[model samples]
Target: MIIADLHPGLPFFLGALVVLVTPLRYRWIPLLLTPLLGFINLMGWELGTTTELTFLGFTLNPVRVDRLSYLFGILFHIAAFLGILFSLHLKDRMQHIAGLCYAGSAIGAVFAGDLLTLFIFWELLALTSSLLIFARREPRAFRSGTRYLIFQVGSGVLLLAGTIVYFNDSSSLLFEHIGLTSTAGWLIFLAFGIKSAFPLLHNWLTDAYPEATPTGTVFLSAFTTKVAVYALARGFPGTELLIYIGVTMTCFPIFYAVIENDLRRVLAYSMINQIGFMICGIGIGTELAINGAISHAFNDVIFKSLLMMTMGAVLFRTGKINGSDLGGLYKSMPKTAAFCLIGAASISAFPLFSGFVSKSMVMAAALEEGYHWVWIGLLFASAGVFHHAGIKIPFFAFFSHDAGIRVKEAPTNMLFAMGLAALLCIGIGSYPWILYDLLPFPVSYLPFDNTHVIAQLQLLFFSALAFVWLKLSGIYPPELRSINLDFEWVYRKLVPTQFSNLVSAYQRFAEIAHRLWVYSSRRLEVAGRRLHGPDGQLSKTWMTGSMIVIVLLTLSAVLLKNLL
Candidate 1:
């Protein structure tokens, strides 16, 4: 196929195979060019372009280029490039191959116009990304990758099941708005929810992200959940339930993130918090709200990946990531420290940062929709995010008391990736209109008004003040060498423990029941032998003579009665 006519995601997949054979010295050629070529292919199409095929008597649209999908396609391309760039130093080819395939799968999913097509890529997404986690080459990564796969594959299973039911009910496989009016919608919504890290089903992200290799976590953060966000925006916009779910997602994670010791895991919690904003905007379902969500997703990929990259660099250099263990690194890794602060400011939604321009739109939409309570909840979440992710992450990792640990700064390749991301964060923050134009809807919302700016600054300022006060007073939660539990404790610990006990009890009951059954069976067999066995009582030759005498007497009596 010609470059313009080829599928946008195909290059990455095809390049992955090529990467397998390329020598280590020359592998960068394909690793970098794949996403670049994919982006060029993606750019060749106009809106509403589609490619179709027939499979198993079903007409499928495997390639659909429209405004929404186009936005995500562009975002994924940028993310893929950044990820590949970040991981260029790794000697492990498996990580390289997995990252490319996983990126390709996410891009394919974004362009899919049919549920089946979407499902095909959805599963590829799960399988390929799992390999990245497993690339860590450790027991924890293996176990965590298993858990991650279960959730991701479970999502695909739900999607397939829902697609079947929806097709049976509607006779359509088109991917479009599906409100929660039927079983199919609910099933599909749930599938999106699990991947989206809905409140109770969220532990997989926190558990698995920290265990992956540094570069692996960067890839993990960018794709899977964001794809879920895209799906939800397309499939379940304006779902009232999502507003509340998103609120909970934003609020609950703050507490955990504040107390969590692992720096990367804190970012994981922070991720849920940011996604909550996107979910809320999508739930609002206004044009501005949808635009805000997509724009934020775009901004988030760059900034979040930047943050993960900085942490990864730290882990690579110092062999430590815990807040308690990392401190005063700014002395040696000043460039990395600077990049980390930019990411923190962006995530915290500081004025003139990437987050400021997009986050406000969602809050504005909430207010415009008269969901005052939801607006208030989102506002509170914004402050909490600043507390944990914004200030806490940078403060502890790079600025706290000296841990007496010294190491070289991050490598050149890692610094370049972080620099690129940092520039985007600033560029987008400076020119929100560029991103606003890329949104699915027409753009008119302004994020830099005096009131909005002042209000946001006040909230962030107070949040930071409170953090400082708490820390000075020694009331802030100390970083400790202990396990903190979340809802997963039920499944991870309590459920298994209880299940084992139940199995033991059932085994004992079965043993007793088996003995009683054997005893009763033996008794029944003996009784049956006594009653009907050959040569037993009343089974001899006397039976024939007695029978003949009884028959003769009965016949005489009957004849006498009849004559009378």
Candidate 2:
């Protein structure tokens, strides 16, 4: 059998089983090697008829390696490898197994040739990724994992419901663009929106990610949301509503990120903000715009995971992830600090950074599509991303006041992982053509125009200058060990508190009713005893005789009146 003929994701599932059965000391062997095999298989397939399976009268395509899916598959495979390298020191077999399965499911989802197959892999992605949270083996992590699983599985449920409805209506289950012209399409759109973290449905990303284990957070940061992005780009392109929704997602997260004390949570909020740009590009639905969204997704997975891994290293070393408790770490972990700066610059879209190359595509599309108001919103969001994700994260974690916390550099394995991600950010940014070539569409946009570069620099530099001014003038909000409420307040705090209050009210009403019942019963007993008890005059013989004499007098009076 030609190895190239195997499904790209088959290697991961097979590898996960092997990792589970392998001895503890040897488990990393499968962890380190599977992605390479997966990548090899991924690259070997041509553009058509890769693999398929027939199940229950549905023509399920397990492998359809088109340009669009291929780009995502390659990116995911690379991310899986880097993730494995990052966790090489870990002996937790469950995490390794779950991580591999999670990666495999994501690959399967991307390459799935039909809605039915995609949904199958989509649900698997949720199941396997949630296990990563549980592998942390902490009570808080367990709770977060449970909540995360709800949002995830909920999305899959919606997809399944939508799929049923769609099949009933159209008698087809192709995973192509099903626009919002019918109920089925709308359900699927909402399902995609939930996973994409669109506005009100978004708290899951920020709520559960920080509570995961450090390494788990790195994997958590990369795959799930981006997969949603892929689905949206494919399914809801030019849907118009996405543009407004994306704008809202972009602007809302920055405020929460600014006030957030947990550095990991800050990154989580920033993840939504980054996705907003992609959503907007998809909304534009032009070749250039869609290209921008895909390339940005690619860039986001790398840099976002890089920052997450860096923070994971910090948490691993210091046993703290809050910004209020961390500072001056550059003194000890210079390598990590440097790598973090690269990730920051890349995220900030500084010239010759990966973000600079990709994000520009979206902004330019917004302008060319006559979305001037939307363009303005995106520009402001761009600066806001730099303010919080780019500046706030690094400044507070590495360069703020000396907190007297000293720790060694990140582990060699971790440093290796971070190095790989950092290199990609710089590499892709410096040479846009290499990434552009991988885009689903041919490259037409240029990143290095004198006018465009100058404007971007001015915008970013001014944003940085504003941050410095605020810090020096004592206007910037100080990081505090306090929770900043977001949409999660609706569920985590408000709903629970309201339910508790309702229970209290019910108890009070029940107490009052019980007392009233007792009082009424006592009154009835007293009244009954006064009328018929043995001590009463009416109950005795004298009362009977008195009643007879009164009846005789009444009869005599009635006879006299009749005679008159």
Candidate 3:
């Protein structure tokens, strides 16, 4: 049987069983094994084995492997392996197990031949991934995890509903080539939109990412949104709406990241911005653009994970992730500083960095597709990326003002994880063809052309110049002592206050209405008692039974005469 013919259900079922049975001390072993198994199943997989099986009258594919699916599945396994390795030191088997199952489900969804299978794995990802946040056990973590779960599971529901509509309309369950005009397609798009961090649906990312455990954040960064991006590329490629949405997504978050206090949260905004690039690539819809998107997705998972790992290590060691509280850490943590700088430079698209290779492909595709304005917007966002992630993250945390606090370097495992990710970042950057060859389409694009390289260098240098100029002028927003309100404030603060005020007004109205009702009830009861009283006109029976009998006899006689 082809690798595509291998059943995903077996792995998912076995993974959950192993997770349940495996002892806590050795849980990482099984966690590590599961992804290996998935990787084995994914590598060298033959395309187009879209088989359907009916279990208790519910159809499931068990195997739906294709080129697009294989790309996502392979990366998800890589992410899972790295994530498990990164978290091996932690004692939380619950998180480890949940994360494995979550990764498995994401891989499963990618290979799902039909919407039903997709929805199953889709909900599973939400359920399992939320456990990572809840692993912290803080009240804030609990609340944020709950909110995150609601949005995630709600997205799955929308997908399922869309699937039902799709099947009803087309009499087919296959999940392929959905359009925006149909209800099913629109629902599915919105479902993907939520997880993909489309515009207003993005607050959960920035809200909950910072609240997760240091290791948990690394896992959080890789899988969920990127899987959604893959799904969009799979199910709704070339949807024009994504172009506008992607541009908006790219531009808005820079300001937020610039003004934000928390370093992890800053990365979260930057993540959304990067997703916008991929979305734009998908929207452009050429073979080259799609390949660029898929290639970028692969590179993004590596470098983004590396960046989060560095920040996670920072939080793990110093217990300070806020920009205002952290600085001058290179004195003690040179390795961490070095890894962080690599991650920053990679994200900033520095020459011979991973981002430069993949990001340029997307930009080139955009320009080639005649999206001149979008290309310009993407260029600005590129500079802004350098400003926030490149300059703000590393400079403030590692080399800026000395806060007079000395912390040890990250633990051995943390450094190992960061090193692994950094190696991939540099390896991919130095040789773009290594990634380009793995794209869904034949590789015709070159990221190292003179024009592209010169443009990128100019952009990076200019952005750096801007950062230095602002710093020298003392005009850059100083690290704040307070948390600037983000989109979450709408739900966390503004809505709650407004809801309380509305409830108070309703309570006042209810009190007045209650008094009126009680008064009216009491008056009616009094009226009833008075009407039923013996002294009342209706209650006073005059002449009693004798008068009633005489009246009956007279009426009977008059009726008889009229009948005659």
lDDT of 3 by residue, 1-564 (tens): 354445653564477688778787777677668777767766646777677799767676766777788778778777877787787788776877777777778887888888888888899889888998999899999999999999999999999999999989997887788979899999999999999999989998988888999989888899899989988998878887787788888899999999999999999999999999999989888888788788888888888888898888889889999999999999988898899899999999887999988788788888888999998999899999999999999998998999876988988878888898899889989998877777789987777888888988998898899989999999998999777776778888999999999999999999999999999999997887787776665586768787889999999999999999
State the lDDT of candidate 2 residue by residue for 297-380, as single tens digits. Answer: 999999999999989999999999899999999998899999999999999899898999999999999999999999999999
Candidate 1, residues 428-541, lDDT tens digits: the string is 998888888888999888888899999999999999999999999999888875658998899889999999999999999999999999999999988777766685564555
Task: Please identify model 1 stretches exceeding 4 Å from their true place.
Answer: 511-564
**Model 2 lDDT, residue 450, Cα:** 98
* TM-score (all chains, Cα) for each model: 0.91, 0.95, 0.90
Displacement of residue 19 (Cα, Å) in model 2 is 0.9
* Ranked candidates, highest lDDT first: 1, 2, 3
Predicted model with the maximum TM-score = 2
Assess each prediction's global lDDT (C-alpha) against the native.
0.92, 0.91, 0.85
The residue pairs found clashing in candidate 2 are none
The TM-score between candidate 1 and the true structure equals 0.91
Q: For this target, which candidate reaches the highest lDDT against the unseen true structure? A: 1
Question: How high a TM-score does candidate 3 get?
Answer: 0.90
